[model samples]
Target: MMIPIRKEQRQENMHLKKTPMTKDMKKGMIEDMKKLKRYSTVIKSYSYMKAFRLLATSLLVALSMGFTSCGEDELDRMPSTSLDEGTLFDKTDKLFSEYIKDYSNIKCRYGLQGESSVLLSGLKDNHLWFSEYDAVSKQLKSEWIDIEKTDTIQQLYKGYGEYETLYVKYVAPLYYKEISTGNIVTFNIGGRFQTIFTSNHKAKRTQLQYDNSKNGIAHNWYKESVFIADCCYSHEGDTIYIAKSRPSFDENGNLAGVTLVSYEEGIELSGRYINRRSFKEGKSVWSTYIAPPFDVPSDAKRNYTLLGNTTNIWEYKCEVTFYDGTKRDFTFKINIDNGKIVTDEIKVTGISINENTVNLKQGETFQLTATVQPDNATNNKVIWSSSNETVASISQEGLVTANSAGETNITVTTEDGNFSTTAIVTVTSNEDEDKATLARLEGTWDMLKCYGWEYNDQNIKENWEENVVGEYIFFEDEDGNGGYNDGYKTYYFASSVEGNKLILRNSEWLDGKTSIIITKLTETELHLKAIDSVSEENYEMKRR
Candidate 1:
C-alpha cells in the first residue's frame, strides 16, 4: 500500500495533453462503449458502480474543457480523430484504476494496522502551534510551521483499511494519549514540553524523558538525547548546546537556516544550596540546587517564530485558556547575559559535614567529608581549611590531624559561590604524658657500674666494680622488671612501679625482692640503689 511517487516522473507526466471529447460525443459515450463486441461484457456495460462514477466524472470534466476551447480562434483548433469504441473504453478504465491505486498508499507510520492507534498524526492534524513574542512590544515576532494537534480522547481501536496496510507490520510500543477540547492538552511527557522544528532548522536539540518513579523527583528528567543535524548524541563529555540564535524564514514558508549557541567561559548561574535533614549515616548530607520552570505557555495556539535577540535577558508571561473557557497566567524569564544562557532561579539549600564536632587525642587523626546539594550542581568543588594549624591541621583531602591539645574549626567552602560550613574540632591532652613516659623507657640498657654492701660491713655500700659490670639489661615497662642477660643465662623478674620508685620481685630466688631508689632518670643515664635485708646493690645504667 506504500506507493512511492517519483517526483521527476510525475512532473514529466503532467505536461502530456489529454485527448479532447466534444459535448455531443460525451452524451452517447456509455451506449457506444456498450456496443463494442470485442471487449468483455463487464467493461462494456460499466458493471462496477465505483468504476461507473469514476467514468462519469472524467467524461463530464472533458466535456467542460471542450466547451471552453470552442471560444478560442478557429485556427488554434486541432483536427479530431476517430477511435474504436472498445479502445476508448479500455483507456478510460485504465485511468480510473490508477487513480484508485494512488489513494490506497497512505498509512499511519507509528502503529500496526490491526492493533495500533494514532495519537497525533504527523501530517496536518494540528490545532495548536508554538509561538514566540517580543517582550517589550508584546507583538508576534516569529512564526513556525503548524507543529501538531491535541486530541480530546483516546483513539478508537479500528484496524487499518486495505489502503492502510503499510502500518500492519510496523507496530509502535510507546503509549501516548492526548485529550484536547479546543485548548489545554493534558498528557504525560516526562516533565518535558514538546517542541517541533522544521527539517532544515539545524539546531542542537535535547529530548528528555520524565518519570517520577525512575528519577525520585516530582518532575524528573530521566533520559536525554541531544541531536545536531540528523545525528543524535547521549554520551558524557559531549558538547552541550545551550541557547540558539533566531532563525531566518523564507517566503516559501520554510526554515532557511539556524545558528547554535554556546555557554559563557567563566560566568556561572549561581546556585543556592541547603543541608538535608534526611540522609544516609556516615555520609555527607548536602542539599542540591533546583531549577525553576522555563515559564512559556504550555498550551497555546500561536505558531513558533524566531527570537529578536539572544544576548539580553528577556522576561515572558504566557496565558493559557482551558477547554472550559477558564484562563491562567504564568511568567518566567530567560536571557543570555555575559555570554551565558541562564534560567531565573537556582535551588541549592545548604551543605552538610558528616561530623559536626570531632574529639581526638593529641597526635591522632580523623577524616572529614563534605557534600554539595541539588545533585546537579554545576560547581561542586569545595575548599578545605582549618582555623588554627597549631591546634589541628587538615589536609586537602579532608584528613584532620590533632597537633596539640586545643580546639579549631574545620571549614569547607564552595569554590564557585564561596558558601561555607564548619565542623568544630576539639583535641585534648588526656593520657599523652603517661604514654610518652612509657615510650622513653621501652629499650635496652647496659649496667655500667654496680656495688654491694654486706650486713656485717660498715655504714655505706662499697663499690664492687667487678660485679655485674658490662651486663645488658632491658626494661619492658616503666615498672623496670628486667635484668642482665649474660650470654648463657636469661634473668627474669616481675617488675612494677609505685610513683617514681621501681620495684623488682625476683621469683627465681626465695625471699629475693629489690626496691631501687631512683636518683637520676634521663634519656642517657639511669642511677638506682636497691637495699633489702640481705644486701644493698647500687647500679648505674646507660642506654645502649
Candidate 2:
C-alpha cells in the first residue's frame, strides 16, 4: 500500500548529508522532474495511484537535478510497453448481448431483422438465416470460420448471395407461397429437395429478402439426402414439415417430412446467452394456446419476441391463424422506427382460468380471464378458447364471453411446452331476486296462521268469533290476496289496509294464511321471509 514501507532503506539513506553544491543540484533536478509529468502517456508503467506518487517523487528529484549538471530528463527508469489492452475479445456472447440489449450508441439497432417470409420464386427471392458460436474474433476478414478455420454453420450462408455481416445479426423466418397454410411443402425440381408450399405472403406485398436480392439456394431444397431425416411437423401443425439447411443440395427430390434442423436468427449469432432483461437464449422451446390451432378466433393475432441484446431489443410481430388452420406472421417494424420486439420466438403451452363455474343471466355479460405461461417462452404469445366451439369461444386476450345459454368449458393453451387451464362457464337466464328468496325458504309453503287474533280465551271470551266474524292472513301485493294453500286447502284474504305483507293464515285462527316480506331482489336471486309466522323461515330461489 505505501510502497511496501521500506523502513530500513529509508533509515540508511537518511544519515547521509549532501554537500551544499550537491543539495542545490538535487533541488534543481527535482524541479525539472515535475515538468515531465504533464503528459499522461508518461505514466504508462504506473498503476493509477502509483502514477501520482511517481509524479510527485520525480518532481522533487527534478528540483534537485536542476541545480546540477546531471541529466534532468532521465526518464529511462520508467518501463516501456504498449498501452493498449486490445479491444475486448467480445469474449463469449455475454458482452455483445449486453451491449446490444442497450445498444443506444449505434446508428442502426444492433441486430434488427427482416419481416416475415415472403414469396420466393426459388429464383427471385433472397434467404434469411444465421449461425453463431461461443467464441469468435473480428480480425478474420475474408473468412468467417473463426481462427480454427473449422467450418461452422455460418459457412452455409457464406455465399447465400453476397450477404455481408452486419453490426446486428438476426435469425429471420423464410416464408413463401401465397399463404402460409402451416403446411411445409417439399417437392423435387431440378434434382434437389426444394420446399415450395411453406408460404408467408401477406396481402400479396411481394416480399423482399434481407439482402434485397434473389435466392439461389434451391440447389438443395427439400430433397432426399444424407444430410436430412426424421422430419415431422409439430403436433400443432401436423402437415407442416421443415428441415435443417445445408450448403449442399440433396440429390433426390422428396418432400417426406423433414430432419430436425437447427436454425438461429441473425440477431443471435454472438451467442445464445441473452441479457438478464430478455430471454436467456439457450435452447428453444415451443407450446400451443387454447383451442386447437384452427379453432382460435379468426381475428386473434399472435404476438411474441426473441431475446436480443437488451430486453427492449425485440422484434414485435403479429400472427393470425386462418380458418383453414394456417399461421401467418406480420410486423409493424416498417411503420415504427424502433419496434419493441427483437425476436418473436415465444412458445405458449397450457393456460387456464381461475373460475371453474361462472353463472350469468339473460342479456347479462361476464368476463373470464386466464393466465398463460410457457416453458421456453422467449415470447409470451398465448391463445385462449373454449372446447365446444358453438356454445362459447374465447378471445386472444384470454377473455371469455357468454354466447348462449348452456354449459361450456374455457380452455387456455400457452404452447406445447406450457401448462393449460380450463374453466366451466354456466350461463342461465334466472334473476338474482329469486335465488336469495328461495335459498332461505326452500320446500313447499302453506298457510300457517290467520291475522287479527280470534282465539277463545277465558280472560277474553268476547274475543272469540268464528261463525259471525273471521280473520285471515295471506300473501298479497298492493291489490289484494293470494291463492289457496294447496297443502291445507284453505281460503285466505289480505286486509285492504296492509295485505301486501307475505303471511300465512293458520288453521288455529280462521284460515291458514302466511305473510311474506321480500327484502332483497337481483337478477339471479330473490330473498323472501315470513313475518310473525309459525316458524321464522326465509326463501331464496334461482331461475330455472
Candidate 3:
C-alpha cells in the first residue's frame, strides 16, 4: 500500500522559500516521510507541489521507491491501515501506563523477594525437615533435608520411577540432606557449617558496611550456634538452651567444637550455648527444629576478635549490623591493625631539654631538643618560648637566637598537660673589643664555603663562588694594604674581634662597622653567621 505525502510540503513551497536542500536535508526528509506513513491516512490527498518537493528533497527516497517496485517484499511496505489521531494517541497513552505499572510492580516485588523467600522456606535453611512418631510401635523417626546432602534425599529422587532420572538431572541434584538420631542430639553445634549456624565469637551480629578496623568480617555472615538437643523422653519437660559460642574447652584453653581450632589462630570461635526450649512436643511428633535466626547485637563491638601479625600486612574480618537491620561481613587489609589491644600512655608526666645551659655570642643561634618521657606519652606536643624576647628569640621548632648581650630562659611546655623544661641562655657581645682576639683576627682569610640556615636546619650546598670572587679578608692593625686583590678590583677593611663578634669597618663600601658573630674560631678555620633581608646565611672561611 502506498501512502501519499502530506500537503505541508506544497504549502511550504507556496511560501516561495527558495532554500536549496542538501544531501543531509534530503536524508532527514526521507526519515520524516517514513514516520508520517504510520498515520498517513490522516493526510487527505496529495498535492502537485508536494510530489515536486519530494523529488527535490532527496534522491534516496526516490531510490527506495524503485527498490519497492523491483524486489522488496510486502513486509517492507507501509501498512494501508490507519487510525484517527485521537484513537492513536489514546492507544499510546494506555501502553505507557501499562509499561509504568509493570516497571513499578517489578521493583516492589524485587524488594520483597529476600524476605519472602526466607519465610516461605519454613525451615530458615532453604530446606525442609520433618519428624513423625508411631504411637503403636513406640518409635520415633526424624529426617533432615538440606540442599547439599545427596546420599539421603538425593536417593529419594534417584530412579523412584521413570521420572527419577529426569528428577536427578533437573531437580534432585539441586538439594542436600543430612540425618541425625539419638535421645540427646545436636545439629551444627560448633558452627562448622557456618550458613546453618548464625553466630560468631566476635559478636552475635555482623556489619553490612565497613568503616573502621574493629568489627568487620569481609564478605561473610556472622554464624554461631550452641543449642540443647535432647532425645530422651525423661527430659521432655526440661528447657533447651542455645548459645552463640562453643560449650566445651580444648587443651589450649580455646573453645572445643566441630573443628580442632582455637583463638591462637587470631580469630576466636569459642562460645557457650544459651537458648532454651521445651521438649514436650517431641513425644507426639518427632520434631526437627532449625536453629532460630540469630539476633544481631545492636551495641556489639566489631573488634572483638583480631588475628594476624600487625607488623606486616594482614587480613582482618568482622561483621557489622547496619542501622536498617541488615548485616554484612567486611574484610580489610591494613598495616596497623587497630583491632589488637595496644597499651599507649594516656598522659604525659615529664619533659626535659637536651641542653640545660648554653653560652652564645650576639646573633648566634642554637637548636634545642626537648624529650618527652615514657616515649608513648599521649601528647608530646610542646610550646617553645623565650623568657626575654629582646635578649633571645625562640622559634616554634626550638631554635634559640641571641639578639643582644643578656641572659634569658628558653622554656618548652607540653601541650598535652602541665609539664615543662627550661634552659639557661647567656649571650654576651662587647663589639669584639678584646686585644688578644683582635690580634688573632689579624690575618688574610679566604672564604671556602657558604651555608643557608632555617629554623633548625642548615644546608651547605650553596655555591659561594657564583656570588663573589676573591672573597678574602685582611685584618691588619690600621694598614689595609694587605687586603685581597682580584683582576677587577682590590678591596681592604679594618677588622677587630670585639668580644665574640667580628667587627669589619670596610673603607670601600660601608661608612659604619659591620659586626658578625664568630660562631666557630680556630687556628685554621673561621665560621661567621650573618642575617639578610630574607634569611640567615653562614659562611666558613679558611685562614691563609
Count of clashes, each model = 23, 121, 50
lDDT of 1 by residue, 467-513 (tens): 55557667776655565575457687665554456656773422354
Sliding window of 10 residues with minimal summed lDDT for model 2: 68-77
After superposition, candidate 1 runs with Cα above 4 Å error: 1-345, 359-366, 395-397, 415-420, 426-544
Tell me the whole-model lDDT of each prediction, alpha carbons only.
0.40, 0.31, 0.39
lDDT of 2 by residue, 351-420 (tens): 5566878775434555666655544445444567777645566777755666666778777665345566
Q: Against the hidden true structure, what lDDT does model 3 obtain?
A: 0.39
Off by over 4 Å in 2: 1-338, 341-352, 374-376, 415-419, 431-517, 520-544
Better of 1 and 3 by TM-score: 3
Best by lDDT: 1
lDDT of 1: 0.40
Task: Please state the error at residue 532 of candidate 1 in Å.
Answer: 36
List TM-score per model, in order: 0.21, 0.24, 0.24
Candidates in descending TM-score order = 3, 2, 1
Compared with the true structure, model 2 gives a TM-score of 0.24
Give candidate 3's TM-score: 0.24
